[model samples]
Every structure is written in C-alpha cells, then in structure tokens.
Target: MSLIDLSKHVALGIDIGGTNTKFGVVNHRGEVLEKGNLRTDEYEKVEDFIDALYEKVHPLIEKFGKEKNFDGIGVGAPNGNYYKGTIEQAPNLPWKGVVPFGEMMTAKFGMPCTVTNDANAAAFGEMLFGAARGMKDFIMITLGTGVGSGIVASGKLIYGHDGFAGELGHTIVKPGGRKHWSTGSEGSLEAYASATGIAITAKKMRAEFAESMLNQYPEEEINSKTVHECALKGDPIAIEVFRYTGQKLGEALANFVMFSSPEAILLFGGVIKAGDFILKPAKLHMERNLLPIFRNKVKLVFSELDEADAAILGASALVWEK
Candidate 1:
C-alpha cells in the first residue's frame, strides 16, 4: 500500500540520532498517530540504515494508509543539511563523507522528503508544537552528546550561506583552548558543554575528590545522568561539574545574544536533565556577561517538548511548513 497523499492530511516525522532513530505520523493538529524507535547501530552502511528505516516505517505507513493521510516525510538528523539534502560527515554516525539522505528517503518512500540538522528541527518543533510556539525569534539548544543549536531570526530558520548556520556548539567559546572529542574542532563549545564534555569535566573533578560517592560507580558506566543523580544526592564534585558546565554555556550564549537579540534561549536534551544544576549557573554567567540593554530582556527556558517525540515533530513540521 502507498503512503498518504500530499493533498490529504498529516505528515511523517523522522528523527535520526546517533543512538536511535525515531519516526511518527503526525497531523496538522499536532497529534501523533504512531511512533517508535530503532537502534542506529543495526545498520552497517548508510544505505543499510536507509533500508532498515524504510523497512520499519513502511509497515506503519501501510497500517495507517487507509485511516489517516500523510502529506510527506520530514527527517531530522545529525549533520543533516537542508539545502544539500545530505548528512555530511556526521560525527556520531559511522557513515563517511556525504550521504544523499533526502534523495534516498524520497526514493524509498515515494513521497516528498525534507531534511535538516537535528538542532534546526528541534527549534522548528518548539515553534510548531513546543515552547517557542507563537514566538517569532528564539534559539533552541540541544544539550546532548554534543551541543547543537537552531537559530530563528525574523521567524525563519537561519540556514546561513552554506545551509550550516546556527551551529552554536561550534562557536568558539575558548579560543585555542581545546580540541573537540569528535570533530577536533578547536575551542568549540562542544568541547566543554556537551554531555560528553560534562563527563570529561566530571572525570577530572572525580580525580580530585577521591572519597566522593561518585567513586562508587564504575568509570565505564558513568554518564551525565549518573552525574545528575550524584549531584542531587549532595555530591559536591558533581555539583561543581554542572556549575562549571553551565557557566561556560552561559558565557557562550551571552555572545550569541549579542548577535541575535533573541527573546528566549530554549534548552533541551540529556545534559539539560541536570536541571537547576546547569540552568542556575548558566543564568548566573549569562546575566553577568550580557550588556545592560540585553540584560533581563532575554529569558532562558527549558523545552517543554518530550525529547523522544521532538525530532519527529520537528521533522514533520519541516514538511508541514513547505
């Protein structure tokens, strides 16, 4: 059976992450009909990943084929480029070089397909169904394995000249400071603010406080979530790590605000799970660094959207916009 016709209703939203790929069929009313996740490591090659996704999605499309109509497929992926329709050198994905992502998905699904960076997708998702709803200008920051950002100016996603704008993570926070864990991008904010970055920072702090409860966990199993749990339990080291991370993030956002003057900066993803540990410090530093004119004018808020459903909603919103 064929997918829903464009002239009908709703759209398919696909969010491809480093660890999982999530997809859903959503209508104009922001209601999701069906949604699920697939492990990203199952596929060896890029083509294999595409095939696996279609295999999983095709059944859902057919199952809902007779009930609700899907207008198109919208995909949100790491390193995905909107203009080029490619996932170019994604750090987490095993795929090398540029993968013709949109073309391949379109061919497999026999429907209109649109692709954008996961950050951009998240920002649009917020605008369409989440925190930024009804807002004209804001920034959405995804604080996960890495820091990803989507900039909306004048109510439009800033694609930049090369369709790679709004890369807030790669913006230099510490000039000539350190190398990024994945991309080797020097002094990038991801080096210090991502989940991995937080873990790295935590590891350093753990070494200094050898008697802390954090030592109870095996090093291999440690993660940002674990750190948050430890901090909540009054682990000074963990708290310090979050404070430091948030401070750095705030400093970075302060610079971004100077350029964009956004109404709010929305935070999302796993690292943000640190909640006040991260937000408080970030707000403190952001306020300290901002100019008087911008101070107290811009707000920093958390994404009310569910992380699992956001990419799908964001991706679907991309097609819905078109």
Candidate 2:
C-alpha cells in the first residue's frame, strides 16, 4: 500500500461482527462503490470464515479494479489488534485464541491489510469521512449492544502499549455495583450504558414500578429500541431509564475528558438514534460532572455517518491512516 498512489487506488473495508461480516469497496472520498454481507456465525473455523469472506469480496475487487486500482484491505473486528493484526480472545466469536487475521487477509487479497477493533475503526472513519473530519482530538464512544470507545489525540488514534488502548466500556464507573455477566465485574460502563445495559435497567425499573408501561409487554420485549419508542410516546418508565443510563455515560465521559481534554465526544450506533432522549441528559450530566476549569468546554454530539455505511467505510479508512 505504501507504493500505491492512494489518490488513484480504492480500498476494501471489512467489518466482522458477532452476527455478520460486512464488506465494501470504497473510494478515497468514502463513497462505498460496492458492499455486501456474510453470516459470521455459520462458520465454525476461522480458516473457513476467511475463505468464505474472500469468495464474496474478491468479485467486487475484480469488478471495481476495471475502474480503479485496488490499494489494500482494512478490517475491523472484536478484540482486533492494530499492532499485531490479530483478533484476541473475542468472547462472542466462535473462533478462539489470537488469530493472525491481517496476515490471512493480506495473503488472500494479495495486498496490505490493517486490523483494529470495531470502535477504533469507527473513530477513524469519523475522522476521515464524518463529523470529526477536521478535528484531531476527540473521543468516539459507541453505544450499541455493548459500549466501546476510541481515543484520538494530536491527530492519531491511541492504540496504547498493548494495542488495546480504549476499553472505556470496561472501566468501572461504580465500584461493587451491578455485575457484568461476561467480565463478571462490578459497575462497568458497559453494564450501565450499553443497549444491553439499558435492557437491564428497564428490567430493574419494571421490578420497582408495578405500573410501568414496559410491564404491558413481555419482559423480553422491553429492549433498547422499544424503550426509545416508549420514551418518545411519553412513557415515564422509559424516560427514567434513559435518564439513569445517561447519567452513568455522562459521568464517564467527563472522567475521560479530564484525562484527554478532547475537543468533542462523538456518540455512535443505534441507541444514539434516540436523540434528545439520550443526548440532553448526557450533555447536562457531562458538563455538571466536569471540573470548573473544564466545564462546558467539550462538545458532546452524535455521529454524522450513515449507520449502514459507517463500519465498512471506517474499516476501509484504515488503509489511508498514517
């Protein structure tokens, strides 16, 4: 990729998630020229998974090559390591251990391949093509199935010494608080701020409030999406749940801001689509929690990228990273 003229060459971006693997051929402007997805859970072996992915992605590479030169490949996956190009002990994936993901993809595609965790990929995408396009210093927090983060400072993504720098989700906001099932920890931000966390919060509210509108539906039906719908419809229970969740998230962001003093904190993913239901509380709480010196100095905002193209574009943007 170093030898290739990036201005004239397009890149392949692949985002491998727990349920599906999405791939896209994208130009330098962040436009996705071609895109597709494969079911990720169907493959039991990592090798077979790579093979299937290559089969689906290669045709697009070939077709697009006729119009533009293919530079390289970029990948974003759970627990992906940018320095090592490996996926390390991802809890949800069927594949186990530290798999040499980048090398395998490079071999199959006959090009350079870069790998990073999904949040970092999204952060890079935002920097290159979305809201943070001109900003060098910011934190990108993803509020989805699980909370994730990517830290940027001085115009570079901070990978830390171990290449797993931004695990803001695992940071404990409350000591000895609610237990996170996967990490088995107490009061992790992921335990209180993620979509999964919101569901947990909803459950707790249902137990405490006998007349909750959430009680009108089955317990399993009271997910984040439904909670948002309920909130929009003036459901007291749902609004309270979001308020609590936003308090946890806002406090966490204030702590992060103290450490990095970022220009902005960008929120991404489905849960953020709740808009003011989530943002208003989060912004208010974040400012309140900040120190007097830092008060109201940082911007808290939602991502500008199209959710459907963001992951793929972010992965592809890795190729352009210095």
Model 2 Cα lDDT, one tens digit per residue, 1-322: 3585556689998888899888889988898877889999999999999999988888888888886788889888889999999999998789999999999888877989999998888888888888999999999998989898888999899999999999999999999989998999999999999999999999999889888788888888988988888888898999999999998998899899999999999998878977887888888888999899999789888899855466678888888773
Backbone clash count for every predicted candidate, in the order shown: 0, 0
| TM-score of candidate 2 to 2 decimals | 0.95
CA lDDT of every candidate? 0.87, 0.88
Which clashing pairs does model 2 show? none
Q: Give the per-residue lDDT digits (tens) of candidate 1, residues 178-266.
A: 78876777878899899888888888789889977778888876778888999999999989999999989999999999999999999
Instruction: Look at candidate 2 and tell me the lDDT of residue 314.
Output: 82
Best model per TM-score: 2
> Which candidate should be chosen as best, given lDDT against the real structure?
2
